[model samples]
Target: MYRISVDSSRCQGHARCMAFAPEAFDFDDEGYAFVPDGMAETAELSESIRRAEANCPERAVKIEEA
Candidate 1:
């Protein structure tokens, strides 16, 4: 499995990650991107997820082996 998260400090509310991986990311109240609770762990290494990571301008999207 893999763990996904967004570094809130680095995120600039660009929403690129949401565009790429809507199923895996959501925005907080202030419009910053975040991985919803319990949804961080993913069993599949989806192409959209990789695209989201690559497309994030702020480099806030994080994916790590779980």
Candidate 2:
């Protein structure tokens, strides 16, 4: 399985992940990307995470096998 993690400290509120995967990422009131519940098990979650990680200019998103 793949584990997705986002380092909020590194996030710049750019919303790049939201554009790549709206279902997996949502913007908080401050415009920071946050992952809602059940996102890890979604069928398209992995792809979404991958896209987000790749597209993140701040390199705050990461994916790892667990």
Candidate 3:
């Protein structure tokens, strides 16, 4: 398993992450990408998730082994 996170401090809400994997991310009214509280399986390690990580022009995505 993997633990995935978005550094809100670094994210500029370009929405690329959501474009790559909408299933794994949510946007605030202000349009910040974050892992919602109580999110069940958004961290599942998959190609799409990795694509989202790479898609972030801000490079805000973080992934680590869980």
TM-score of each: 0.94, 0.78, 0.83
lDDT of 1 by residue, 16-48 (tens): 999998999999899999999877998987999
Q: Which pairs of residues collide in candidate 3?
A: none
Superior candidate under lDDT, 1 versus 2: 1
Q: Report the lDDT tens digits of candidate 2 across residue range 1-66.
A: 666667889988988888888777776798787677666544334565688889999998867666
- What are the root-mean-square deviations of the candidates from the true structure over C-alphas? 0.8, 2.1, 2.0
Q: Please report how far candidate 2 places residue 34 from its true position, in Å.
A: 1.4
Total clashes, candidate 3?
A: 0
Q: TM-score of predicted model 3?
A: 0.83
Per-model CA lDDT versus the true structure: 0.93, 0.76, 0.81
**How well does candidate 3 score on lDDT at residue 6?**
88
Instruction: Flag regions of model 3 displaced more than 4 Å.
Output: 38-44
